[model samples]
Target: MDARQTWSSQLTYILAVAGATVGFGATWRFPYLVGQNGGGAYVLTFCIAMIVIGIPMILVENAIGRRLHINSVDAFGGMANGKKINKAWKIVGWMGLCGAFGIMAYYMVIGGWVLNYIYNIIFGNLNLTSVVSADLTASFYDKSIINAPFAISIATLVFVIINFVILVRGAVAGIEKAAKYLMPILFLLMIGMVIRNLTLDGALEGIKFYLTPDFSKISAKLFIDVLGQVFFALSLGFGVMITLSSFVRKDENLVKTSVITGVLNTLIAVVAGFMIFPSLFTFGVAPDSGPSLVFKSLPIVFSHMFAGEFLAVAFFSLLMIAALTTSLPIYEVLITVLEEKFKIKRLKAIFITLGGIFILGNIPSLMATNLLSDVTVFGKNIFDAYDAISATIFFVLTSLLCAIFVGWVLGDEAKKEILFGSNGAHKIINIWFFYIKYIIPFLILVVFVSSFYDNFIK
Candidate 1:
């Protein structure tokens, strides 16, 4: 194997991981989930989950990566002091790679939707007018984009090619460069959208719906749902943090870096709620519109708002950039595995990975149209089936295993890496250890079982 390339600097490392974590899960998925589960109650559970589960897992993954300084698979196969561990632990790495690949397949398809929206909005193909109705907006999304297989396929191919070009450039020049520039622009665009949405008439009612707590809506399922969201939002158990942190400087403080990334990611998801919910309420659109909230509901709001076309272009552009930043990291996890495990050259690995993703991604892309609309896996269409398996099964299972590996198997070595560069940080190390060893594993196992019941048995 070749010598691994470290990040250009600490800032770039943080930005790269932050960029990966703060993607569509926050901008596209979080708002709809909040809407579906009851706004304030879901938000409350999400915040608690972040504190209890999200940040601690970030620390665990980063610690393991920096300590071992290898690919995700080998990282679990050995220890820091040149000691070999049980080969069975490699399952965690495999699960993470599978999860990352599964996510990328459908993620690129969603990216295509964003790209198509941008193109249609800019060229006036969407036929936006002053007297647009909810039905009209829904029709545009359904007929012109979702149900059009050829258009979606072309868009998805374009997105795959774009990622292929970036991946060939290597990490520092490709992934880091993209994150450094795109993350700032993503946040600025989101802030602008939030301000615009807040200024709209009847926006306060939306804000109230978003911010006011309704404890009555809380349930056992809500906890499971919120925990899964935190995992997805923070890129936990997908080998993203582990792979990214493998490139961190030896003297870097893993705890501080994890905390910063967690805080930034969580904040972006909250801001997304501000950006989306108010607009939905202002236009009297149902907040709980499920997956179509952004694609369907927001276009309607933009049609009725001032400078609607301009905002529409900007919003989708923001979504595309966020999607790219995230897709790059997830793609990297697959590339790294192939390059390290098979001794393949980077260029060869890039082609192999992209080719696989394109082929697999097409299933979901075409399923959106009549071509494969009848296809179902586990009672979900291909797109939703991919989402459930990646998020509920692979993500949760990999996370549960990682907690056990780091907490029990790697115990002291993991602690040393977490506290490496920080003086006087020993006091809270015990608390963190307690959470990772006992609390996080138990909680994740509950989610894993509950998800199976909800998806299969229930």
Candidate 2:
């Protein structure tokens, strides 16, 4: 492989990773899950999981990448101490790559929805300034976007092309440059939304609902949900962290950077809760509205607020930025695989990967509209099937293998990479190692089985 591309600076690395970690999972999925699973209880469990499980797994991926310093596929098969471990371990990296691709395929469909919303809002197609009723808002999402095949497909194509443009520029000038701008704007939009939402009447009630813990609501199921959320929200187990970290400077502190990435991810999810719940309550909408919370419910809330159109624009723009930042890295994982493993040129790899994604993405996009709405895989539509299989199976399985690889296989070598620039913080390093080695794998196993039960068997 050619000399690996490193981030231009530590700050850029942090921002890039932060962009990867903090995507729609934090901004879109977390709030709804908290509402459904018991607000404060879910948030608390998610935080604990982030500390014990999320951050440690992140450190493990970083260690693997920095130590191996190859693309995800080749990295696993690459040398460790001048010897190759079993090539079967390469499956773990492939799983991560496949999982990332699977996710990006459907993720672009949703990204298209965000793009559609932004365009419609800007063009007066959505008409938020008018006295739109809840039914009208819901209908707009259902009829105009979700069920509109051409609209959704075009938007998805545009979103994919946007990612392609940025990624084609390579890591330093492309991914890092986008992150340098997008991450800050994402935070600013999020904060602005939170400030605006909190000022609404009855906002305090939503805040209370979000923060006041109901201990009685905690359960094994809730914990399982929290586990899945933390993993997905942090973008772990997908080789994203590993691929991004492969470019890190040798002396950078893995522990500090991983923690910072994890913290920023969790912070965005929490802030999303604050931004969303207050608005939901203020508008007399149920917080537990499932995935539609952002698409259907929020629009209704925005229509009633002062400067509702501007807020709608900002909110969807924030969502788009989060989506784009994340899509870039996930898309890069595939591009890197082609470039490193097949010796394909970067430009050719970009076209090949994007073409595949667009083709595969069409399945879900068409399934959402009248064109292929009847199509089903494993008794679920293309979109839900992708989401279920990726989250419940591929994600957990890859994460489990990664934990085993770093914890047991790499062992002390991995520890050395993690501790390289930390000035010998042995105690913390040991603690992190313990969780990665033993606790995290075991916990992921529980989540794996439980996820199967919840998603498939049950």
Candidate 3:
């Protein structure tokens, strides 16, 4: 995307980044991870990690994207002067694209679940079953497979319309206005839920689980996941942020925006944990599990907590918006690339991505299990395999390239762009370079090297 065609105001771009960063990584996923990682202790550390490691990386991403006016792939390559990195750097872009779209493909399916629950809630119907454990929905629960695909289809159509209408309308008309409206409403609804959760019976226990620290679980893997969450949440390496930054006028502050977006994003995750964890105790379920804890466990747990259908209605509504905010950006990145590279109409690009994802999205929809499985080079689910590949494999490579680009090749322009945007940011920027150049890459290397790769070549 041309710098001329992106968001106009700094705030809009920050909101757009906020929109991208603040969703699944925070909402259900945040609580779920805390549950899995040994309760509030992990949650506390994750938040701390976000500030220490995530913030600088976000600045790096925003600066790199804004300064280069190119996606990370091309940006990384052009920033380098040595060997031809054109091909190698392009792989970063492709991996980012794959990761974003791949996530959305499955995500739309989950988003559909939220939509289905909304309909079921508003209509005063519940898909309750006696034999079905609340943790796992009964056999009847392929609601996404049934209703979600169509819902996603419609939503994707609407998303395309909204995105292009904004992109075409220019920054003020489209991006800023949308963010100004959408982000506040999202935060408001979530905050209200958090306030409500605070009064619940088991809320404090849940809070501690989410906010308190358990030191033993802080291992290399936990840190790695935290690092990945920072990257994944910020929409880095994918060129989405780059594309968003493209719209800013040169004077717009990049560093402050990165920090603002990071703070807001992390705050939401913490709030989400506060809102979600207490519900586990309120409903009498273990909160120590991750995604499965939410989907399989929480539904049943909520059934026990709230009166009648009110719980389902509230939880799922927040979820739908959360999912939409995140998923929208996935398509945004694709649309930006397609429109720029193919000169295709924005509408056409949106449809192509939607349609392609709709089909690929089904591999999970059809399977009785996570699509991450069934993808076996040796013997792991496609879901786990992909998670490992996307987060660990691609992330390590991308971080290596990004660090090398920012710290080694693009240092001066990066310095100028970051310093121009904020007060006392250069010190952080210097530390950022230090981490990217040595610390982060080293941590990522330990993750990769220590990882016992399953024999699955496929």
Candidate 4:
């Protein structure tokens, strides 16, 4: 098979990347965030916000991927008729490419947490001691808590190794194959957790908190946050979508595939909410749990509940699978950049990238903050700093770039590329051009600039 000719149908392509997008951040954390935002209304607001804004941006992204058939760094270059044609756009590509590196630097630290739980599930008896849970959580952040740093570092490396192995194998085996098998597993586990959580007392409050909307709390910024979360949850800006969509079969329906991705990703998040909120309310654990929601919040809630240990085993396993699936794509982007840029073989690129990232990733050995506080920003820590900056940099630009590319670069050609074999979706295509060209770009620019001021100035 020719390396360039390898491709997946729109279904596999969307699902694979969607699996990456639908990480623990959405499933486990949505309810937690909703709880913080005061209840079901936040989730309610998030849904509307996601569909309206997130979906269109995603469609625009697929257009870039399918049209150019290249990675993020070079996608702009290829579309401009080579790197020299519209040199500035390449900066967009560089931002995305570097964003991928930055994401994995900290993502592995989080992935390490999942890895640590998995290790405890497999070999060691997970001490349900509240003291132990507090100790473990503290270990992740507390310097005086010696075991936490070692555990986080080890877990991060384990995640890096797994990613290196899969990506070195290339797309079919690494992405498509993994997506086919693992997505089902992740979903099934989420469904299982939902079933278990709902059966508990106070579960309905969790459900209501997740699904019911507090109309008064529905503010403009919260709505925007939901929109951004939906996009981030879908992992669109990490450049994985652009890189992965490069492998799509030409005859596939780009619009339909994108819609399907939106639906699947949304469904998983909703399902995860059901799984989490029910358990949360039932346990009298206030649903507004924050970072402690996953590591600290739930474990404490489950300790005194029915079949808590078994459920913990199931929850962590599912969470790990979801994280792993997402981690694979980041690894794919990092290694692809190296191979394409340096003319290195894929295997060598994997090792070089893995070793380099693993070392740099130790910055998050602060996941618990025992020895060092997470590198702080306006009040956020190192992890949030990376998440905020990377998500902001990649997504805000992709939205703007998609608008420019489809509006100007492709123009009439944009319709043709999107409607390539997708002949019937013309109505939406017409609106797409208008949105991409005029409406969205300005919105993206405004939000991008505003966020900078908000973060740095006040």
Candidate 5:
């Protein structure tokens, strides 16, 4: 235990990080967002944001983690080897840890819903049929989620324990191994769904709508949505990239890894568009069903198609895999901090973290039902309140602080370490530094403020 654990290889690191990046953000949210917003235009905006904002921040986080060789809190706590700077900066890491835990709380609830869907499919409990309208799907959500807290709790516990077993095994054997297999299977499932959907009659119409850029639909709102999606999709501001990079061997090229992971994440999201849009059009289903696209509408599509039961199983299975991969890293964010900071054993850290999340996180599940349905905070229910706090507020604030810290405080030291073994290191670092210092931070602030305004005031 004296020696720090590191990923066995660069490939494992890529797969693991990609697994984290490609979860619900790409697999679930991206497709539906494309359907809701201007399909091709939203995708294009997302790509640009990924380059300007996503890649640089990712590199910054990875650089900080690898350079500090510590958990998120201490990573910021020891910046520039200065005591006062370290003490103040530690708050940044704590904010990130809070964001991670906050996200995990509600995220596990959604993960449980996916688990329930998979179970219903297996047990033939869901009598899905025909293409459901947006309202109908919305009604389904109202009828379903959190109606049975016992069942939801069971599913949540199952999800948490699965993560625990994987995390308890340590970095390479646990996370890397799960990512190596799960990522491939997830991709295969996506490819299969896309191919099957494309083969359906009228599928091209959906694809056309998705790929055709309707510039008229582009608005200020769409732009903000794209930026938020890119940030959330890349898992920025969560200290996840930082934690993941801490396990990376020092010789790995941070820029190369960041670019690869970012590109892979975007590509998977685009491909998911092909899968979702085509199926929606082919089945005569409307595209802009918001969040219900996956849980409610997609299953309706499956119910009407050939081999519906099999496809339904595969689709939900894909979601479960995506959710599991994403949740594992967030769990690690807390477990790593607890183990490193408190000097607890890994087993002890896992239980302590899970116990806390288990007790505290499920409040969202309760609020999802009639018991606390009338309860509201900041104009949102408990579940949405948690999401806004973690996903929007904390995430954006943390990313802004990270950009400022790397751009100004870490300064030359970070630049040198980040560029250490790469070709054209100086030029690349200059562009990255420019974005990290000036551009990315500003965009994060805009996203942060706008999100608050839209969620609370406007």
Candidate 6:
């Protein structure tokens, strides 16, 4: 058997976890959600949700993994000796694994799109002008992304190959090293953008829109939206925290680690709001552009900035780094499962996983454009269908099961994990347990039902 692997330090573990949490969403989707949802009020709700729900669950997932010191699937199965534990609970782990795979299948396509844009900017294939319009940017996306199907396929393959190389190198050498450098660079670039954005004329107007709370916007949907953001933004519900924590040294302070990771993730996302909204308002652009906020809308702003070419390079570089950091932990989750369950050699397992993703992912990439545009699953194209299944159904279901398992099934053992080394931790653990058992699961169920309605029923 292979010798056990553990993160060299708490810092590296935190970096890996934070990296997983900070993806493309941190750059674009988060700020957009804040704008559309409730701005400052949404931010306030999200922070509350993170503290009450997100942080506790992070600790719970880590405790399960560190205590068991195994892959997610076996963590539940190993909760008790052999057949004593309900074997069906292991399906929670399977759900997580499947969710990760499903997300990655389409996620790589998005990553490729980022890469293609980066290439266009650097190589002058995309002309960077002083003034750009939404129409112009839309045309560029259509020509480059929608019209060029083979390019996307090649990009996806390249992305899969890149992940395979890093993953095959093992965690410490691959994930840890990448996060150490990439994360800092990502922060620096974001800070630069934040400074540039704040200096823009009418920047404060955007800041006002972002910071001033409109409490009336708070409602059932607001809570649900904030809950979903808190859940997904922290990379919860995917066995990722479990898989990553399995590599953490037991004596490490998981409480501090969880808090720090959650705070940093939220901070970056908030700063991303500053990076986007201020410049958006200064350029006289609307903030409600949704997914196009990143690719279509941002490019117009980028063109208007001083030394726009250099800023564009930095922005895209930051994006690639963000995508890579997020991809690492995801790859680890899938690879660890393959390594444990199939007893396959690490290299062989990497190839097997990548080969499968490469083949399955192409279908989504094609459907995103011309070839399979007519294909629909429950009224969604192949790409959107995969996204809905993973994000809405599998992700929420896994989180609910995790809360149930830790709160009820593990019972006292779970409490011990939460309260392990702290003085006066019992009261806090009690509050956490109550929330996890009752409140958190119910909240997740609301999101699950809402998602189901939007995806299938509505």
Off by over 4 Å in 6: 80-83, 421-424
Question: Of 2 and 4, which scores higher on TM-score?
Answer: 2
* Whole-model lDDT values for every prediction: 0.86, 0.85, 0.63, 0.70, 0.82, 0.80
- Residue-wise C-alpha lDDT for candidate 4, range 130-232, written one tens digit per residue: 3235456445433322347776776777777777767767854687777888888887887777777777767777777677778888765565566567756
What C-alpha lDDT does candidate 6 achieve relative to the native structure? Answer: 0.80
Full-model lDDT, candidate 5: 0.82
- What is the number of backbone collisions in each predicted candidate, taken in the order shown? 0, 0, 19, 16, 0, 0
Clashes of 1: 0
Superposition-based RMSD of candidate 5 using all C-alpha atoms, in angstroms: 2.0
Return whichever of 2 and 3 wins on lDDT: 2
Selected candidate, larger TM-score, 3 vs 5: 5
lDDT of 4: 0.70
Give a tens-digit lDDT track for model 3, residues 5-42: 65656667787778777767677666776777787566
Root-mean-square deviation of every model: 1.6, 1.5, 4.0, 3.1, 2.0, 2.0
* 279-398: candidate 2 lDDT, tens digit per residue: 888888888888878888888888888889999999999999999988898888888889988999999999999898788765555564567778877777788777888888888899
Question: What TM-score, over all chains together, does every model reach?
Answer: 0.97, 0.97, 0.84, 0.90, 0.95, 0.95
Alpha-carbon shift of residue 274 in model 2 (angstroms): 1.4
Q: Which regions of candidate 3 deviate over 4 angstroms?
A: 1-3, 71-73, 77-88, 124-175, 304-308, 362-378, 423-427, 450-458
What TM-score does model 4 achieve against the real structure? 0.90
Model 1 earns a TM-score of 0.97
TM-score of 6: 0.95
Off by over 4 Å in 1: 80-83
